[model samples]
Target: MTTGQMARAAEAPYYYVPPHSIYPIRGSLSMLATLLGAALWVNDFTVGPYLCIAGIISMLVTLYGWFGDAIGESEGGLNSKRIDVSYRWSMTWFIFSEVMFFSAFFGALWYTREVSTPWLSTLDSQTLLWPGFAGTWPNLGPAGTIAPFKTVSPFWLPTINTALLLSSAAAVTVAHHALRAANRSRTIFWLGLGILLGFAFVACQAYEYHEAYTELNLRFTSGAFGALFFMLTGFHGFHVIIGATVLSVIWWRVVRGDFTATHHFGFEGAAWYWHFVDVVWLGLYVFVYWM
Candidate 1:
């Protein structure tokens, strides 16, 4: 078909093909299993880990199958400018919703820091009764809980990880621009570097968490600081994983000639999402950790 014809064909309503699919259901099943496994494992259930592994493998298979089909269609010109536009809109809306979600968490943090914690600390009734009340975000117990129970400081490793994540973000931006310039090698190299940087951030976080639990005695069950730290940083880690995955996919697509300098919204959208995630982590660092 001519380019115009192919474009028109792609613009045809998706209904023409009858939207029926098994992947979505199958994918959900795998996710459910994995979620159950995680829940059970966290509670020290015996069967949880086995189910989680099985679920993860199943999910990987499902993703491979589904993405393979989409890739084939895209490479075959079945996807047109219209599909690209739709994806752009979809991704934009999805990211915007995520922004609002994170904003709510940030708002909660603001209220807690500025209003709730101070209010709770000054209550004479509590101090009169529970005399040892420390009134802190990360409440320590048993008077001197020692080194393990100490509050985490953002000065050392956390700062390093912050730099790592921000640097990776810049590298990803470079790679994105390289893609638009049709500089394949530059794109791949920068993207690969970004992925490495992402891995480094995750590794540092893993070590930090280990130290927090073992040496610092901070945990999700600890108190406000612990709760906020885990909630904000843990979610940010998940987003980093996703961003890395997107970058990896873009790298592979580059190798396969799936995108062009003129029309590669998929690559651009993923880049945008990664940058958004990076920005969120910046906010997390300032509000959740440094503040």
Candidate 2:
């Protein structure tokens, strides 16, 4: 290495390794409690719901403390350029994992629709094992098994949500540009708008769920279609909530002068996540709703 580069490397802040703590164990235990409670609750245990709620609360507390410490470290200027690059790589891999996660569900949907459904409806299986089974996109099991239900359409609700997510994507992009220009007020304004639109999308989705359950009779137990629908959209909604929360934290940091024109990986990381959420939603809009 060159002499000046070596000097700068030596002068750079040492990598920060947080002290060992119980947060990991605590978080794990909390998740165990949640799963245990859910298993019990499904079997009609009385204390199960309470235990689940308590577990969720504990998990939230653990996350708050854990992330709060990381935020504190970053704000204290202990995070170096090396740390920032590591964080970027970490986020990239995490998002790639999420992509594979959703791709599995999408693959299931495609396989059921295109391959399995038609394969099952062939001559032998339909005649002997199952009679009068139609090779439709959504087979309601050999008839009379699943209750009659309506599918979710890409109507006003889903379309409106599409618009909301698309708009939020634009807003966050604008906010990124503003932050790069060191325009704090403009950054905050645009970021807040993006966050607001995210929550608005969530609200509309809640209403859509209500409509689905009440009017359409679509539910988790509806059929394969129902299962895939809820699985895909529900997970996407949860991610939206997470992305908005992260962006909200970054927004607060911007307001407090935590980042500069050149140093704002926190904001960039959050924006990266938010954009990932947007892209996932578009996939859902096309495959889940319209298709």
Candidate 3:
């Protein structure tokens, strides 16, 4: 076939597939199970865990089957350079949307800390608009809050976690360079170290949370400060979890010889995400925790 013909043919990958199952049915069933699990988890219910487990297992199977077909198609020489470009574009847009989603939350946080508080405390004639209202950013709502706010100490484990995350990022960067140089052994070694460091960072964060809630009274119930604290760091922590998963997957793929200097989009994408997570945390460390 002509290059153009092959390109056009590859672009319509899904066009040839026969519709088999109802996505709504599958999605709804999984959602129902997950919802039950979440409800159970929230309220300490007995069946919630089972429901969630079933839902997760079913979804995993579905994903495996779906992706397996995709892999078969890909390896069968169905994809063209045009299709690769399209995939890149789609992933770019998806990541941009994610960035914007996080931006909204960041904007809300910045507004609360900078503009909202000062405006609320303004002595202008419109001060009656908030009569007896005290303006504060981190510490929001009534005199104190639902519980109370306590500053998290960054001197100990938090500091350690910070170091670990930074080091892990550094290690990943090294591994990336090693991959570029085709130094397979050094690349694997560095990637492994980065994975270990990432896990350690998570462990430290969990310990920090425990210490904050148990001893420091730093909790979500404590109005603005607590809210921003958790929302910012909590989401960042979630990204870390996702980044770790991405790296682990890449590690496995690397072992399977799925990547190389010229065809390592998966590695590059995961690396981009992990570095982004690290950059976000650096901001959180300064603005959220320290400043």
Best-fitting candidate, measured by lDDT? 2
Predictions in order: lDDT = 0.78, 0.88, 0.75
For model 1, residues 150-257, the per-residue Cα lDDT tens digits are: 666888888898899889989988988898898988988998899899889988989988998888778886655667778888888888887888788877888777
Report lDDT (Cα) of residue 213, candidate 3: 91
Estimate, for each residue in 4-58, the C-alpha lDDT of model 2 and write its tens digit: 4434533677876778989999999999999999889999999999999899999
Of candidate 1, the 10-residue stretch with the lowest lDDT total is 140-149
Ranking by lDDT: 2, 1, 3
Runs of candidate 2 exceeding 4 Å displacement: 1-13
Each candidate: RMSD:
3.2, 3.6, 4.7
Which portions of model 3 miss their true places by more than 4 Å?
A: 1-53, 123-132
Locate the minimum summed-lDDT window of 10 residues in model 3.
10-19
Model 3, clash count? 2
lDDT of 3 by residue, 169-228 (tens): 999999899888878888888998999999888888888889889998888777777877
TM-score of each: 0.85, 0.93, 0.79
Model 1: pairs clashing at backbone N, Cα or C within 3 Å: 148-215, 148-216
